[model samples]
Target: MRLRALLAERLVSRGLGETRDTRPQASRLPVLVPVGPQEDPVEAEADMRRRLHAVPAGTDLVLRTSGSSTGTGRLVAVSARSLLASARATHARLGAAGRWLLALPAHHVAGLQVLVRSVLAGTAPLVVDTSTGFRVPALADTLHRALRGRDPVYLSLVPTQLVRALQDEEATRALRQVDALLLGGAAASTALLSRARAAGIPVVTTYGASETAGGCVYDGLPLDGVEVALDAEDRVLLRGPVLASGYVGAEPGGGACDVGQDTRYHDVSLAGGTGQGIARQEGGTPLWRPGSRLPVTLRPGFHLLPTALPGELPAKGGTGTVRVLATPDRGRLEEGRLVVLGRADGLINTGGVKVDPGDVEDALTGIEGVAEACVVGVPDQEWGTVVAAAVVLQPGAALDGAAVRRCARELLEGSHAPKCVEVLDSLPLRGPGKVDRRAVQLLLSRS
Candidate 1:
């Protein structure tokens, strides 16, 4: 199967599954897939056989961002501690350990995380081969058997997969039976999410990336021991046990926070905080937001974990204490939960003003006739770079290009409104569910 072909080397090297030895080996240096989204997986696996590969010591698994749709990628080294920290935090949030239904591509961070989480769960995950495309019947059959297990069953799926499943009554029924459906990999519309939740499906929208070992924040809340901070530019700066060591081959990142020092408890140099220590309310939980400054030197060991139950954590590797990994995504805190706006690099510069395309996309999708929208900056002599948009209208809905721009102006600032709007049958995708913004830029450039 494509899943095995893509992930066999990674899984076997990590010593996963009863099919393999599945034993933790301390001598094992970090097993790196190390290939970016656009690289060949077969070639990446071949790199595993080389005897001379080198990376920072204590690094466990090295993965890359599947920026396939965004036309970007980064290779990050995630230490053993960090991987487990991410897995354990997920368990703490989900409230139970069970079989994970792997629905995303195995090479992707979210799917790779299924392996990491399964190790802690002590239950082998049932994987679906997504390389051939998502089949609703396959999902139905798998969920049926998984639901029969003694332990609770969990499923991870992209929003596109969920959309497909929602269309088939059998698939929808099977999905409703799972523990919690993790919806991520791309942004889900408010209309789609509301419909899923309203249909008795427990849908949890996740926010995070490969740098954090996948989905560190769930449904707008940071996981246990994971802290979220915003840089001076309002870009998200992630810290704590879930953070990756840093990008592979990049120069050592300079941040205000230094980690792996002597501190079991979390200390703060955060933005929107009152005192030196993290402020606590009535429940004794520290308020993660409202810090005084956008400090990138934020270290780990933030939230207190639950007492060790049997198999509460993967009994492997060292502590994942490290400095902040600054993300390209722009975000803000609302009621202490992180609200990711869009990519910082994706901001459009027009007439000396920067506009967030994510904000524009949100406004566009909110319109009645628009089914999907992709926003990008198009080069223009007058404005220098004007906000341009490409949209896929709902089936049978005829939306005029001018009407689309008029609707956008009503919902957002003039600068945020699309100067050029193009209608398309569908947005080009670089991978499953993710929009190819760069391709959309090329398409919008022609308009």
Candidate 2:
């Protein structure tokens, strides 16, 4: 609430009239119209005004879920209090004093956070028009102009934007000038991260959502007062000061389930998991994992699991498979350092063994003629799903599928090798800069 009040005060102070009430809107296809000096602010304000006036004062703003890949709509309401808490937590995490270059859309939480952070940090964010799609050279030029005063600059971008920037010499140079480049909204590929680090970009990957006030966890670490724990099913659950008041339409559960309570349930079902369990109690219903259910006891304040599930427990102790449920794809904590593995969906399941495609992709990076390769699983009567790779060879480079398979065999295990290789000019990439497996399957089927 303090953070929301602070944001409202800041907006009002910055010439936004008190009559104008800022409200968050949720939509399956949320439109993010980038307004500039040339655009009509009166019209823009009118549109927002109409939306805010339509909803009652107590009504929460339901924003669409960040990723629409699953075709499931998750409406996350950003309360006035949660918005402010996020700003404060972000301010505390990322020290004050720095201008932010906003390339992300305001409709999404990450972009909204950048704008809010700018207001809370006492600096207005410089917006870049990515509506015409990302133009690395143009973006770099705008960023260079924005940094004319030698002021420290900060920017937030998804992995795709970062990868495109790295491919452009001008953009890459421009990125090196920034104080920090926060990457989130989706998982960044290992190839992309390695390239950024090599280019000397101060890149930081953030994890969180609109429910947690945006990026509560930066680079695998939680922000101040943010608590992280794995439920019995190994799904990540978060609590602490940064949590939203509650979703709009959802009942006001009670005191213990009120503001600052565990306010999120990340669906890890795709990776073979279930929901975090719940416990019934006076004044509140406790939510947790069912099997490893905690005692029907009340702890006055917030608590975090010291380590991730399957982390504290011995690896080989259980009879069932040692399924490692990672919240973020590709990263494993080894000796306290986060080593990313890419995305879980990107993993290739061959012969009943899981093969992280990233590892195979890394191995094939330096191979001759192979420009880009995406490993995926294809329906097989014998193997259920066998590893298949879609490869894009460099211009004028002759590609031999057999040679590529031989190369993979030399670098990876027999089960991990691509069982079938389909050569293409390019791979289908999604909005987040990840390989669009569905599109690839369609292309493969046609071929």
Candidate 3:
């Protein structure tokens, strides 16, 4: 049997049996499932059975999207060919040829890609427990163990994991031990990436999804056979060998090829909030729109665009197409290097203007007594929303809301200035470096 067929067979035998049916199963995998710290193989098996029941027979493709909390939750269908192509493309791009530390959940495409790459490379991946979230201190030990074999060790981490690793001195040191670290899943804050680079961590930003098997674009460049294009709307679209086949629960005639004109192109629009475009054909020609009406463009054969429309209009008023596709949520491609903004979700829309909280945080990084800061939009009747900042002070340092606000005004426009500031010993971080915006909202609500 061909390698693709063998892979399909293996995938079917290993919890993907539901894909073998031609008719869709009654119940499919939940689009989102949150796994706790403990692993229950029996429960997992049962869940897999339930999920498999939803897919059609002879369907080897499976689609999984990201959940609200990060990790694995979304489900999309992908063909074995797409998965293999993605693995091969990643291996070729990274030139990976050794053991890898798998700290992400197996249900996630990123984590699953690591496993698939390991198998393709004829090496077993070193698994780690990410059920309780990323434990950087513990991961340090795992990294050490994975490196003992003298094989070129590689690992993938989200910004949250990178932040935690940076917090631990040992883990920071351990980062240098790997051949490469693919930092992705979401945008890494500028502060976080700066710290990682300063620590001499060989980190590369990656972009892709289950549709592409894994990371199809590394550091703003497409992998071999992966093509990236931007539509008139500035949304990013992708076409390549690594693209997935389709989605599991997608409406009939809803695959990537249904967008407009051709299957070779897809639409990806950032402005639409779908974070992906549509694949359509016009006059037998394929065209991709970056910004689609859907909240997310999932399914195989459709690739997320690499570029987004500029958040703000250019200063000179020169006319250019502004499109938005979802990937690398923070940074953008400026010149050639990826210049990261903070987070799209982190942007504080105040008075009809979007303000990246990181912009404020970055300007205040060197302030006399500020240790860390988070900026958020607070509800205000006067203005649609007012800019609010939460600051963590350094030990033995004195700072006040007025002082911080004044400082912010000096560094930012009046429109971006903070109306209220709160001082704290430390900001609440969700996983590692991620500021819990919801918690921040709650903090202000009580204040």
Give the candidate number with the greatest TM-score.
1
lDDT of 3 by residue, 1-447 (tens): 132234434544444322635443344332222232354968966766666434433345464464333333445666555666777777777776678888876656776667667766667677776556667767998988887897888888876667557768898888887888998775555666677898999998887766567777788777887755443322345566676655554443334433323223343333344433332322323233222222333222333322323232222432222222233244444454334454444567777898877777766655666666767788888778887878876566767878988888887898787888899766665432345666777787567
Estimate every model's Cα lDDT from 0 to 1: 0.67, 0.57, 0.60
Decoy 2 TM-score against native: 0.65
Q: How do all models score by TM-score?
A: 0.74, 0.65, 0.66
Q: What is the lDDT of residue 176 in candidate 3?
A: 86
* Cα lDDT of model 2 by residue, 207-285, tens digit: 7665676777777776777655443332344665666433333322212133224423222111113223222223333
Better of 1 and 2 by lDDT: 1
Candidate that scores best on lDDT: 1
What's the candidate order when arranged by decreasing TM-score? 1, 3, 2
Candidate 1 residue 284 Cα shift, in angstroms, is: 28
Q: How do these models rank on lDDT, best leading?
A: 1, 3, 2
